[model samples]
Target: MPPHDHHHPILATQGLSHRFKPSGRGLHDITLSIPRGQFVVLAGPNGSGKSTLLRHFNGLLTPRAGTVWLDGVPVAADPARARRMVGLVFQDAESQIVGETVRDDIAFGPENLCWSCDAVDAAVRAAMDQLGLTHLADESPHLLSGGERRRLAIAGVLAMGPEVVMLDEPFANLDYPGIREVLRQVVAMHGQGRTILLAAHDLEKVVGHAQRLIIMDKGRIAADGPVVDVLPLVEQYDVRLPCQARLGMSVTSWLN
Candidate 1:
């Protein structure tokens, strides 16, 4: 059965723990609840388990000793439903493009989910239009610019009709204009009332747009709260506070 939208927390974790072999680095007792429509930024230095935690939300990686819940149901009980609810955009945009053209790429997810051909076309068209990729619908993914490629990746996820959108380092290695373009798209998605959880080491690029900030260190959640309340402690966790916050100025949107 499809999980209802009435669940208090759209996503949650309890005592979650996962340790990689040999290195023994992973999440430790992560417990948190994310309300629907919340915009959260998960920040931390490398190896802080941000990626690992996101994976658990969608059942990509099973928990070693904990539980993940989506829409009030155990994710382990219904991984397929969990994945349908949570759309994850990985750090690498290039690696996500499987189709030859932009339109084909966006339709991939819905097609795999067994949607009818008309439904797939509608979803692909809607995603491309929302991501501003309509003009490039026929273009090859290989020829897209950095910003275009990132948007394509996101469009593919959007085509899946997910309720929660999680992006891992959405803005990496892009020039200033590219960053702005991608940031705008992310903000627009959040505006549509979908829950958004973005994981990035650099907070300055996105801190302003987030309602809550979560900082992780050494595979544990070091801090989590409203962006204002968490900014002060971010540096201690190795994630730099935005320059505006450091100067006692309000963190303004990157869109400006």
Candidate 2:
């Protein structure tokens, strides 16, 4: 009802909780805030509620008992707006490819948002160019390599022009080169001043790229702070410290 506060955290959750009907293995009383344009790495063991927390960001999943806010407004108040503001790239790249070709895939979101045809085309072109997919615009997504497919998935999300990008286990199942490719794109996106929340079981690949590190355990935030501060606590919560960190060395970007 009032004017929007531009200074609000890009994403915030208050007492967020969700439970899988029978398993009871979901987020619990999780509370956090991610400042605009900050890159954060979320790490935890399998089933530590990392993915569930990410789902709450873009209205992909409703919290059983809590509130999600996007830009100081409750997500439930305008789910479509929340979704548009926060783009999520799933772990499985194949599952996101619905269009017959790369261009079609990238244009899907903007088209659904009812953007003009010209606008959609422009957005698709920009997204493709940013991710080095312009040459493959006409190619089939199914025909691309693992890294290309992942980049295609990200391009699709980027076309929508989300202010916040959330990636769930993006490096999962990706080979060395695939991981590096995706990592570069992720870093570039953050450099362009978009908020980044990446959840990973293996922090070795992305920890260095993040300014903050959050470790989740049993659906609760076990630790949260600057990467240099929270990183040392990861191993205490079952997350392995990055190889370099384990050796008492500074963490460096995978891109290096």
The number of the candidate with the highest lDDT is 1
Which parts of model 2 are misplaced by more than 4 Å? 1-5
Q: Lowest summed lDDT over 10 consecutive residues: which window, candidate 2? A: 1-10
Which pairs of residues clash in candidate 1, taking residues 3 or more apart in a chain or in different chains?
Answer: none
lDDT of 1 by residue, 32-100 (tens): 999988999999999999999999998899999989999888999999988888999999999989999
Error of 1 at 186 (Å): 1.0
Encode model 2's per-residue lDDT on 40-104: one tens digit a residue.
Answer: 99999999999899888999888889899999989988889988989999999999889999999
lDDT of every model, 2 decimals = 0.92, 0.92
| TM-score against native, each model | 0.97, 0.97
Candidate 2 lands at a TM-score of 0.97
